[model samples]
Target: MKLARDTWLIFQRQFLLLIRNPIWIFVGVFQPVMYLLLFAPLLKPALNAPTQAEAYRIFVPGLLVLLAIFGGLFQGFGLIAELRAGVIERSRVTPVSRLALLLGRSLRDVVSLIAQAIIITLLALAFGLTVFIGDLLLAYLMLALIALMTSAVSYGIALRVKSEDALAPLMNTIAQPVLLLSGILLPLTFAPSWLRHVADWNPFSWAVDGTRALFAGDLGNDRVWQGLTIVAVLTAAAVWWAAREFARSVR
Candidate 1:
């Protein structure tokens, strides 16, 4: 009960902060829209084959996952900035539960990412894309999983890096390569043989594949189960790592 109460307080604080600075939310929505509108069309000609359409549909889920990942990853900036300003330290000295502090912040990102995913889905629909209700629900669940994984990943980075200024370059460097290697913009089929193998090993690819399966509506139960298993394992590992990092930071 204490943890729950503290988490609620943390949620309130985080939500208020978001309300005060709405630009972050706007940018989150805008970036994905731009990508879908600009990049999707530009690449449409090259990706027009039947296999490519299937691949492209599969890619949409990955893009949604990316939206959540980007939102959660960048949220670490808020934590780093607060720590630098001594705000986090001040909160730490209070009766606030440390776990609540971390969980609440992470939950905020998850919720925000869900909202962003909805926006992206709506935009895709506007573009004449069709997604079944069941498939959409599955995709949303995948987005939630991605957000949780990303939050944990970001928390680990935030705890280790110690400074917001030091985080920017590292975040960019890591995020770009992960997205590219995950086959977000290109299907693994078209990737060079070596790169195709690499994409198979990527956790992000599993997410994309799973989400694509959900959207495609004909995914086998076993394939869906496999994808879920992979994402669950990754999310669990990330959470464990973040917990250890958070403990170290508190000490």
Candidate 2:
């Protein structure tokens, strides 16, 4: 109960900052929207869907995963900025649970990612994509889990390096390969056998594949459960690690 209350308070503070500066939300969603507009049209030859809408069914899920992966990873930039401004230093003196402090920010990120997802979903609809409500909700759930996992890990990275200059290169290096291995732009069935084996080892690949099943309206599929399970376990492990790092940093 105490941890929940502390987390809520910290979430409220971070959410207020989001409400005050709505442009940050827009900027965060812009790149994905651009892909929806520009790049989605170019997938015609590669997508085997019967219609443009069906093609979107396959494409949008990948974009959503792409958004969650990159957006969650980049969240630590804000933390680094706050740390440099002495905001985190001030918080260290507070009686709040260190876990709550890290989790509160992660909660804020989850909300932000969901909001962007809604925008992306709406745009996809406008472009004639059809999605079942239940599957859509599940996709959002996946996004939340991915956001939780990535943001927590990103926070740990930020605390350790504490420098945007170093973090940028490190994140780019890690994120790019993860993105490629995850195969968010297309299914890994297109990959050669050995490469497909390599991609199977990526946790994010499970997630992307699960999302593709969801968007395809296969709610009962094994892929969905497999992806959800992996994401849930990874999220728990990441939160544990981030909380530990936060506890140490506060001391």
Candidate 3:
């Protein structure tokens, strides 16, 4: 209960700060919307789906995953800023649980990612994308988990580096390969055999495949469970590492 209460208080403080500067919320969603409007039309021909709706069915899931990845990864920048401003330093003498410090910030990032995701989903619907409500909710659940996992990792990295100059290039270096390997813009079905084999080891690839399966209404697909399991395990590991980082930094 103490941990939960501390987490909630921190979350509320962070959330209120977000509400004060909400432009980021819209700015984050804007790029995905542009991709949906301008870029996705080109995929219809390449995908050769029977209709645009079918094309969107494939594209939207990948776009959401894209959003979750970049959004969560870049969140470390904020923590870096806070650290320099002595926010984390001030916490060293506090009674707050170290785990709560990580969870509160990560949950705030997840909420923002989910809000952006919902906006993208609604826009995709307007473009003829169709998905069942149950599956859609489950997909959101996956997005939240992805956000939590990535943000925790981001925070851990930020606390270690504590410099935006270092963090920016480092995050880009990490994100670029992860994005390419994950099959976000195009499915790996079109990839050569060797590339497909390489992608098999990428957890995000499993997530993209699983999310696509869910969007296609394939509830029984093995990718769905596999993705969930991989992501859940990684999330646990990330949270543990980030919490440890917080504990060390604050102590």
TM-score of each: 0.90, 0.98, 0.99
lDDT of 1 by residue, 155-234 (tens): 78987898777787878887887898887766677778999787777777777777777788855755466767888888
The TM-score, computed over Cα atoms with residue i paired to residue i, of candidate 1 is 0.90
Candidate 3 error regions (>4 Å): none
Q: Is candidate 1 or candidate 3 better by lDDT?
A: 3
In order, the Cα lDDT scores of the candidates are 0.76, 0.91, 0.94
Positional deviation of 94 in candidate 1, in angstroms? 2.9
Model 2 Cα displacement at 195 (Å)?
A: 1.0
Ranking by lDDT: 3, 2, 1
Worst 10 residues of 1 by lDDT: 49-58
Select the stronger candidate by TM-score from 1 and 2: 2
What is the TM-score ranking, best to worst? 3, 2, 1
Candidate 2: pairs in clash: none
Query: For each predicted model, how many residue pairs clash, with residues at least 3 apart or on different chains?
Result: 0, 0, 0
Error of 1 at 9 (Å): 2.2
